[model samples]
Every structure is written in structure tokens, then in C-alpha cells.
Target: MEYYISNFSNVKKEEVKIKGSKGSFIQWLVTKDHGAHYAVRRFTLEPNGVIAPHVHKYQETVIILKGSTKVCVGREVKELHENDFIFIDSGVEHAFYNGMDPLEFICIIDYVDDMSIHPVDRSCI
Candidate 1:
């Protein structure tokens, strides 16, 4: 068994590219434990940042931690604040926008055995 705590002091921050966008930021804190082709990541988005619309072959769940956001799943759009959560089913186009200051959340993605088989297409942005 593996155990770990991702305190802000030890978590590494990285930038995520937003396709066709001028500016955006995403910080990630990956957990130490890995499940069957799945992973957990703590993600933070800056104000006005967007993840862009895209779809994956696997499922994903997002748990909001701070600030607020507008999430688009399929054809529906919903505003989410702290303590809110959302689930994105496989093959559904989904995206997130950080509209209320800095947004922090955790994203858990379940994948198949080979990640290469489930390529992420970012053409719908």
C-alpha cells in the first residue's frame, strides 16, 4: 500500500496549454498512488483561464476546492462554486472556465490500460 500527502509546500506546479488561447494556467499535484490505469490530480486554474472543450474515452470527476467556475458538459453549462462536483462521462465533450478568481479542484480520470489508445482531441475549442 502507498500513502502520501500533497501539501502546497511540496506539490509541484506546472502550466497547461490551452489550445488556441492567448493565456491560461493550470497547476497540477499528482498523487503518489496509482490505480488500474487511473490517476488523481489536484488542478488549479487562474482567473479567466480555460481548459478548452475536449473529450476523452474514459470517465472523469472534478471536485471543486476554491473559487468558482463554469463547466460545460456536452450541451449543458453549469456554474460551480466551492465544494461543488461534476462528473464527465466517456466521449462527452467537456470543458471548464475559471471565472471567479483562482479556481482549485481535483480531477480524477479513469483510463484504459494503454494511455496511447485514448488520445485527447482538442479540436473543438
Candidate 2:
């Protein structure tokens, strides 16, 4: 078996460019190229940042690492703080918003053939 080690400091943070997204950054910790069946990503949102409502084919689990965020999943909205986590089922619409403090979290998802994300209207959330 192969082993991989990474340092968050060495990972490059890329700006999130999805339509309607603002002040969000993403860092890929593990990817398919790394021989990982699942991809692990770290996301950081600047204060008041927002990730627009969207749904994807792959499900994901999000673990809050720092600060706080308001998450809208399906028809439910909840505030999450550090150490809080949530699971989002496949095809479920979800959105994230940072509060006054910057929000940071880790997301784990399986690498799937269809990973395309479809945007959902804000009114749907």
C-alpha cells in the first residue's frame, strides 16, 4: 500500500469561482490523482462569505474546524460552530454562509464519475 502525508501549510488555497459564490477558498488535501478513493478538501470562508445553493451527485460530510457558519440543507437551516459536523445526502440542495468570523471546515466525499454540481435558486433553500 502507498502512503501519503501532507501539511496544510503546503497546500495551496484556491478561490471558489462558482456563480454567486463570494469570498470562499478551497484547498484540496486528497484527490483521485493521489490514489485516494475519496477526496478531502478544506474550505475557508471570509467573514460574510457565501456559497450559493447547489446540489451534487456525490454526497459529502462536512466538519467545522473553526469559527461559525449558517448552513441551509434542503428546507432546514442551522448554525454550526467549531467541532460541529453535518452530512449532506446526494442530490440534496445545500448552501453555506459565514458569520462575522471567518469559517473553516473540512469536507470528505467519494470520487464519483459524475460530480457535476447543479445550481439551485436561493428561493428553494
lDDT agreement with native, every candidate: 0.69, 0.90
Clashing residue pairs for model 1: none
Model 2 steric clash pairs: none
Summing lDDT over every window of 10 consecutive residues in candidate 2, give the lowest-scoring window: 116-125
lDDT per residue, candidate 2, 25-93, as tens digits?
Answer: 999999988888999999999999998899898989999999998899999988899999999999899
Instruction: Give the per-residue lDDT of model 1 (tens digit) for 18-109.
Output: 45432354444553243234677777777887777766677788999998988877777889899999988778877777774888888887
Give candidate 1 misplaced runs (Cα > 4 Å). Answer: 21-37, 114-125
Which whole-number lDDT from 0 to 100 does residue 81 have in model 1? 91
State which candidate has the highest lDDT.
2
For residue 27, model 2's alpha carbon misses the true position, in angstroms, by 0.6
Q: Count the backbone clashes (under 3 Å) in each candidate.
A: 0, 0
lDDT of 2: 0.90
TM-score for candidate 1, please give it. Answer: 0.76
